[model samples]
Target: MGRWEPNARGRLEQAALELYAERGYEQTPVAEITRRAGLTERTFFRHFADKREVLFAGSGRLAELCAGAVAAAPAAATPMDAAVAALYAAAGVFEERGDLVRLRQSVIDANAELQERELTKLATLSGALAEALRDRGTDDLTARLTAEAAVAVLKVAFEHWIHGSGEQTLRHLLGECVDSLGTAVARGPGAAGSVSG
Candidate 1:
């Protein structure tokens, strides 16, 4: 994929996404994407480093947005609360394009490499959240664990949002997930005073 072209970035990304969604990530090739977009091989390379990069281009930026949101939250907000707020803020950036999220998820689910990349992206976002928390004077261990738990809740909430009824918006589902997590944590290892005896 090396035929230099101009202004093909968006087209290339759109084409890659379409092909990935249509034929699965493993089966779709750079050439196929460029062909569908009516562009040359060089055009694709000029726009994206590779086919997989297209799926993850915005991941870093999204992580930054999430961390920023967390850092900006009021001091009164608990760490979990701040993380959830950050996730909700990021959802506002994402809620505009339900189709894109679904398509990307489909591709990632169908391909191990894409799934790995997604996991890595999630880890990166979690780390960013932890760092942002530290900036807010949260302890390191608390920040790390809280960030990880928040992302887990976000993942569950996102799935519920995507596959379940659309009536429960992401924010609402996130709140439910947070509450569920809190309840679970409150129960602790013994659960319902089992260890008291």
Candidate 2:
């Protein structure tokens, strides 16, 4: 691809991913990424703050999508239901970019810095979901807890999707995780017929 190509941002992202996978995230530099993409350093800077940003660029969009879904959910939906619905909304994006998502995960898995960045992004998403839930009239504590739990569900489902066999979609895994959470919550600490305050 030429530097003047239409998808300069995409070209930069693809190039960064390829380099990150092959050379490792910390080992790869912005210059090499721009060169691989046939783009100038100026162009790379135009689209991303740095090499690491390439891997995390979509986080903003993902947060927006999840928060929007939460905000748009039916008024009668419970906080958990609305939050999980956001996960379902995000599933479509993950499903559409399965290969790239897996590759990106692999890159992050290999680098401690990237892993921390990933966690930070997830926390931001959780905050966004919590704010959306509050906007829906959920109380502060309930909204925060529900959002945190929903983000946990997302993390678990994503791990399973990336590591498990290709039989189940991300959406299916998310549902399974949500069901498991519900079961555990329902059983409580006294499921064996014992009660403790």
Candidate 3:
């Protein structure tokens, strides 16, 4: 089972997730997780800074992938396009494990603390994406708002993928959200002025 325990990090994450789901995140002890995983407490601590970090396994790496994708996008692409592309690229890492994804999501949904941590991770990812946009010459405000909007779309698309009607793929859902955002952006000042009139 050495190959199965190849990395203490993943073991800790899996153990924590299982325990969290069974006993609630707030109630699950770090000791119990390490014990259940057949690992030492020191091994768990070496991988995760704390119990909370165990719940957010892979978030940092996924954010880096997302930011890299945005930074590499063509300048001609709209901010929404860039954001959606990043999310799409990130989706590749997730699409292979639908069952694990659903289980992890369920655990997060079952706890308010986990939900807050998930939101914070998304916000951090958005900031990274905004910085990538700014590096590509977008103005700060525009980059920040565009990043926010893109993340919102990604969030909706993810939810839809997990819980919505299964007719649309996540990539297609992201593309559709981008198109809708593009329409709103195109309407711009004219749409706003007409509304006020």
Among all candidates shown, the one with the greatest TM-score? 2
> Sorted on lDDT, highest at the top, how do the candidates line up?
2, 1, 3
Error of 3 at 179 (Å): 2.5
lDDT of each: 0.86, 0.92, 0.83
Please tell me which model should have the higher TM-score, number 2 or number 3: 2
How much is the lDDT of residue 85 in candidate 2? 93
Query: Candidate 1, residues 65-143: lDDT per residue as tens digits?
Result: 9999998899999888899889898788678767788777888888887788899999999999999999999999999
**Which candidate comes out best when scored by lDDT?**
2
- Clashes within 3 Å, all models in order: 2, 0, 0
Please give, for residues 35-83, the per-residue lDDT of candidate 3 as tens digits.
Answer: 9999988788778889987768688888899989998888899776787
Candidate 3 displacement at residue 50 in angstroms: 1.2
Stretches of candidate 3 above 4 Å error? 1-5, 165-167, 184-190, 194-197
lDDT accuracy of residue 181 in candidate 3: 70
Flag the better candidate by TM-score, 1 or 3: 1
**Please, what are the lDDT tens digits per residue for candidate 2 over residues 1-197?**
33466899988888889889999988888999989988888988888998888888899999999999999999999999999999999999999988889889999999998899899999999999999999999999999999999999999999999999979999999999999998877865547656543
Pairs with steric clashes in candidate 1: 2-42, 3-42
lDDT of model 3, residue 38: 90
Could you tell me every candidate's TM-score relative to the true structure? 0.87, 0.93, 0.86
